[model samples]
Target: MSGDRLTAEVVFDTSVVEDPGDAVLAGVARVLAGAAPAWADRMVAWSPEPRERREIDALATLPDVVRGRTRWATQDRHTGNVELRGATAELNVVVSVNSSPLARVGGRLLLSNGITLTGLREQVAGEPRTDWMRAVFGEICAATRPVWGALYSASEYRAKVMADGPVLRALGRDFSRHLPGLFAGNYFGAPYVGLIGERVFERIGAPAARKAADGWFVDVLHDPFAWRDDDSVTRNADLLAELGPECFFRKGAAEGRVTRAPDW
Candidate 1:
């Protein structure tokens, strides 16, 4: 049977107070080195791209969105500065996982504003005989978790505010109002997750593929809107009803759960 391939693109805007190259490289190395077990079976292929000097300069110029929103620190490893500096880093990384041996994996990593790392993107082309691709996907997911987690953790306000339902709802409403402008260039650019989602769903079957796609979409939308609760869970439950309890939960119905009311 043919299976679907899953793709995800996650962009990280690192708020750097100090030189960011070494920290970014160290984090990437840790992920690739098996720091997250959730990724062990899922990663098909992954790599770190070189940083362009210009990109670093662009990152250094970003305006602070809010007072006290950005943090700066110093590192002696990546940059040769002796004193701490207020800087932010933008790292673009792509991860592709083939669900089927026949599926393809394409990835790219960029630093500063240029394509620092070249030749990292790959493609598998035609179908294969084995089913080992699933594990590869899992590994990629596991490896990237730390990076994402770190980014989210950087902003205590984002973390605290997003965790609350009322705040998330209000933020979602506000974000939806500006969705067009917020997502304009985001749709087709390098290191965008939407492209990854599209590729992954194309290879996988519709049901699971749609679920994954929608999940990622919702997550991204939420990031700007700050909406945290995932309503997809309820929607999924409703859809599963037609498939019956056995298939829905992947467990056969028990004797006590069935109702036997007659219309006599």
Candidate 2:
């Protein structure tokens, strides 16, 4: 269960990148057209920003075409490091973003802004499809709308955010050491299922949550083998501690950060 490849990464943290000029890149080109137009019909292979300033062969010059017939990629008005290839091997995706994935911006704690999604497990051993990636990760969380996100794995997202057994201490962009970028103290950092944007706090510990076509969808496993059944992963970790403590920040909670769903 460890090796043999089975990664369905669809992570998100938000900063809405793509900045060499903006306009039509509108939130990561809708996550490369929601990750399925065979990721823009193959050919983009980027890696140019650290503040890339032209002349890397003029950065190939496709300026946001995306769909078919656009060989190179990233017309860069900002952010690069893309890569796509699909005809086989599970549409080889690798869009590691972070051209400034939120360093700081009026925060109390909770800071992180990654964006990852590696090739969707090219048939990772037996039973790989993992429920057909929950409708392409709910359309990549309705096109990059994630203040918090998850599809889970690597020990079922650390027993579904058990919060490092009272060891949580992330403070800033760590991505995942089992997630806990600190929203105050008890950093529950929501994601027992995935995609829970809009006002991410106002309490939603799951009752099959609801609403999606844009945001919110914590539908905890009716399938996906019930997370290998340990009584359905301990009832989805008691529905993520019934999302109390003012929608999770622990220790009397509610002090700062993620005031429900603050991003753009």
Candidate 3:
């Protein structure tokens, strides 16, 4: 059987201590280094019954996917695949951060930083379903949410933009500022901006209190209902909107469920 191409990107920016670009890179490294679910917990999740240890093997080799860079550039394809019940999904990730200096605000220097997580995946027929990617992304959320909270010590952060599939493609074309050849397939991202206190400046630190607006997109995707097989932009938007900023858990996809939609 043939395979279907699926790509996604989760892009966002939060207040970072010191350099914005460096901080975002550091944050992602920490997450992939077993910061979110913890290496031990993920090992267990990979082999719940102790015999299914393929993921364990994959986990040992995950470090290759965890990458960072100061400048925005096209990366050599870094691809890997996982079996997802009836399908084999191939995926790769690219992370980039750009920092912008802004005029001082509230008696402190203001900065506008950018972070982009671009990835491509192809789901081919025939395979055992797995949750490794979801698990990894969840860990990413766990790792970044608190940092966003601390960065935005005042007013809080909210997703200003979110896109998927063709809509995302169109948005990318319209903007045309993203790195050339950075996106492989349809993209998915949620961009935001926020403010933070000047006193909290450092390279890396412990997580702080979290807020509803912080990492809302990641929170939504972590839910089982985030993925769909259909190519309808309107439908996906409705699904995401339904999962609003305040909703952190699944509430049943009874209304606009796309049963035939492919899982991401």
Candidate 4:
């Protein structure tokens, strides 16, 4: 079967330390270098047990897919106790796609930020049967959760919570007061905004759902749930600005590059 055509720009931010040790920095370096392919492999493999180790091995064996459809780049790893110039402490991975199941799945990943283990697990469990893609989604969700959790937990940073908190809180209040029918409407009855939307509707009623729909629509338009090259940079930067410098473990020396997917 022909694979879905997708292109993504991935960024990795390793942790910086005071008097960075060889082991730590080296490990971080390895993570930075290996994250994308590892993520891709896991996504494809979907099994935490390494099914056949085929996915991991595919990183080396499948050069065309790894190099052409996927592009991996990183910033210079800084040594010593260097103060970062950002709000959130994060290892950012941005994937841009035109038309692919990967895009839809990736949107969920981006929204979750790979931090909420429960959320990720829920997503993996809820996924529709799609053979390889389901496995890929599960693998990506499983592998990244721990990495993201470590980064956020260690630094005490909450990017999504901080960035979207006010909106969520206000929505919460709105839901408690009003019950609107529009709130129950969803994109094809599927949870576009995930459990958050459902919870809002449950607590507030219809009005809350309407507001949530509005919020979700606005979010999709402003951020556009669909893939675009470097589409996430502005949003990520905005989140970083809100989170502050200490949240970040390391800073990239350069901005990421994005390319449009070719029309088939």
C-alpha TM-score for every candidate: 0.21, 0.29, 0.34, 0.19
Highest TM-score model number? 3
Tell me which of candidates 1 and 4 scores higher on TM-score: 1
lDDT score at residue 115, model 3, on the 0-100 scale: 29
User: What stretches of model 2 exceed 4 Å from their correct place?
Assistant: 1-7, 10-81, 103-115, 118-122, 125-127, 130-149, 152-234, 237-239, 242-264
How many collisions per candidate?
27, 5, 8, 14
Q: Rank the candidates by lDDT, best first.
A: 2, 3, 1, 4
> Candidate 3, 113: how far from true, in Å?
6.1
Best by lDDT: 2
- Model 3 per-residue lDDT tens digits across residues 75-143: 432211222110111333343222333333343322233322211232211111123444444445544
lDDT (C-alpha) at residue 199 in model 1: 58
By TM-score, the better pick of 1 and 2 is 2
Q: Which parts of model 1 have CA positions greater than 4 angstroms off?
A: 15-21, 35-264
lDDT of 2: 0.41
Q: Candidate 1's residue-wise lDDT over 1-264, tens digit each?
A: 122222222322232223244343334334433422332222221222222121212221221111012222332222111111112111223322111211211321211111111111122212121112222222333433211111121122233223354544212111111111111001212222342334543443343322322222212221222222355334334433422222111222353443211111
Worst 10 residues of 3 by lDDT: 149-158
78-162: candidate 4 lDDT, tens digit per residue: 2111111111112222221121211223222221111111111111223421222223322332322211111111111222222
Model 4 RMSD in Å is 19.6
